[model samples]
Every structure is written in C-alpha cells, then in structure tokens.
Target: MQIKADSVEEYLAKVPEERKGAFARLRKTIIENLPSGFKECINYGMVGYVIPKSIYPDGYHCDPSLPLPFMSIANQKNFLALYHSGIYADEKLLKWFQQEYPKHVKTKLDMGKSCIRFKNVKNIPYELIAALCQKMSPEDFIAIYETNLQKK
Candidate 1:
C-alpha cells in the first residue's frame, strides 16, 4: 500500500502491525547513531535522514531546495529498504560492512545504486549498519554523490 505520511510519526503510524517493531528498531538505531546536523523526515514515501538544506545548501545535486537525504528507511510490501546514499559505490565501506556483519550479508541483501533491500528487519545488522553510518561524514557522502552524478 502507498503511504500517505507527511511526517515521521505519520509514516510509522501507517506501517503494518507486523513490521512496526522492526521499523521502530531501525528508526531508533538510525536516530541514536546519526551524525550531527542531520534531521529525520518523511520523504519519497520513506523515512529519510537528511542533512538539512541549511548545511548542504546545494542539496543532493546542488539543488538548493531539495532535502538531499543521506539515507532512508522504508517498509515495503515484501521487504524493508535501507537506502544508503553512496554506500553502494563505496567499495571500502561495502567491504567493511560485509566483513563486519556476515549475518546480514548472508541474508537476502540486495545492493543497488543507493539502496539495500531486505526481506525483513530481523535480518538487518544493526551494529554494522550503525557503524557504516557513523564512518562516513556528510561532506564525504556529498562528494561521492556529486562525483557519481557527474559521471552519469
């Protein structure tokens, strides 16, 4: 079902009962480990953690008005999506995560340009995910994302 949430609370409210706990756990982990200046909001039908327009005035692609999220969490019909802005492209980070969190890696983890998809939240590696989030700085993320955008 399509979510109509305009805020984080509303988004959580719309999540199905079975996935509520998982979503809550993921949300808490993200919030507790999130970098400074980043704010959480619901965008693109997902719960996005972003470095507000003020800090990254240029936004994701230098677009002043955009939120330019660094990561996002969403409960999908068949899976939960962990959208990591540039983690897919950063081999170092990917390798680190894979090595550090073998259990999560063994699960159904789908790697994409900027997203990691899992069948359920229980399969997620909270420690590794948090570490990955903690390792990269906002500026580091912006640079990588911008570089990739230029290459395309």
Candidate 2:
C-alpha cells in the first residue's frame, strides 16, 4: 500500500485496518521505551523512530538525507518489517538479542544486515524489543554505530 503520511499521526492513519492494532501497540511500545534524543516520524512509508537529523547531520549511510540511529516498522505484504540500524551490524548485540528473545530467534525470522522480518506483529517480542531500546542511550547508540562503521 502506498502511504501518504509524512508524520506519525498521518502514518498511523494510513495503516490498513487489519494491521492497526498491531502497529498501534508497536508505536506505544517504542514511545514508552525510546531513549532520550530520539524522535519519531513517518519515513519511507513506515513508522520511523530516529535520532533527529540535528544530531547526525549526515543521516544514515545508505541515504544521507535521512537521519541516523533509526529503526523503522512497516507492514509488508505478508510480514511486518522491523528495521534496526545498529542491530544487524553488531555481532554482540545480535547474540544478546538472540539470548534475550529466544522465542523470536527461534522463529527463523527473516533477517538482512539490519532488518528483522516476521510474518506478524504477534511474532515480535515487544518486551524484549522495548528493553533493548531502553538499554542504550543516544550517545551509546551513536558510538556503537560509529564503531561498526569503522570496522567495515
């Protein structure tokens, strides 16, 4: 579905009816657990929780215009995509997440370098995801991201 949202509210409004509850819960979880300095918005047709562009003027590596330290949640044709900017690149965090959210890890969720794809929101371990978000400060997140970039 093409999204017409440029902000959080509009993004939520465009979400198909069947996915509203799941997306709403996801948004709430993210907001409740978000670290300081992160901003939420609708970007690239999805719900994006980001470290505002003011913090990292360069944005993400692939798209310099977009902000950094961001994660995006989207409802795809058959799955929910949880895009993590740092998780896929950090071996330590990946291992930690696996141990922290065993059920989700065991589900054989589709994972790219930083994207975790699941068939439905129910498959997501919201508590674990929230905990992960809460554990890191904005600075810590940026540091980790930078460290990973240097290694590449």
Candidate 3:
C-alpha cells in the first residue's frame, strides 16, 4: 500500500491504475480548497500539507527538522485515507464533520482519531472534503497545536 516514491507526482504514478483517477481528484480537491499558507510536499510517505519552515521556523515539535504537518492523503492497504490534524485537535470541527458526513454520503463514516478512510472511491464525497480542507488556516492550526503542546 505504501508506494515508496520520493515526490507527490511520483507517488501518484505508482498508485494502482484503478485508483489513479479518484486519488488524483481527491488530491486536487485538497490543493484547491486548502487555505493559503499551507505548502504541499511529501510527508510521512504521503502527500502532505504543512506549515513550512519558512512560515513556522520552530518546525514540528516532534521533529524540529521537519515542517509542521497539517494534513496528508495516502492510498492505504484497504482504502484511501485523509489525515487532518484540525479535526483531531478541535472538538467543534470534529462534531461538525461527523454531523455533515451522513448528509454527504450514505455509508457510515469510517474514521480514526485523525484519519478518514474511504473504502469506496466512487463515494469519496469531494465537496465535503473540500469544506474540511478550508476549515483551518495555518495560523489557526498553529495556535491549536501550541495550546495542545502546552497541555502536555
């Protein structure tokens, strides 16, 4: 499932042909809808959206050498995955997404603390994903991340 590619374009090229279109569309949706200030790259082996070192020079607390990751999309073993840090950190945003998902897709939401799993590419609900991408700005995410770090 882990397509060991060095770049986003390379990663996409290695995805199974049956899934190439859906994954590409999902990636496009995130790139187009994400607020300004988030930069795209390959992070943790997935296509990542991050607050770059130029923006947050402190970098990720866990690894100061790396950018602060905001989101990522991966083609996993059984499904496509969207990893959004905002929904994991903010209760209100999580609740809103939980409430809205049923309205967008009939199937029950398959989610983890930060990962939303899409088992069916045909029902990826691109609009809902678009709205989710726009829900947090880099500043907003940085504030929340700092607050959580302080709590620990």
1 or 3, which is superior by lDDT? 3
Taking all chains together, the TM-score of candidate 1 against the true structure is: 0.87
Number of the top lDDT candidate: 3
**Model 3: runs farther than 4 Å from truth?**
none
Candidate 2 stretches with Cα past 4 Å from truth are 103-106
Candidate 2 C-alpha lDDT tens digits along 8-121:
788787777987888888778888998879888877778888888798887888788888846788877777777876576567777787677676455665678878776766
Residue-wise C-alpha lDDT for candidate 1, range 1-152, written one tens digit per residue? 55788888999998999889988988888888877877889767789988788877777655557777788999877878889865776878877765776665565456677777778567878877777778877778777877777899
Compose the digit string of candidate 3's lDDT tens values, residues 51-89: 999999999999999999999999999899999999999
> How does model 2 score by TM-score?
0.84
What's the lDDT for candidate 2?
Answer: 0.77
Worst ten in a row by lDDT for model 3: 1-10
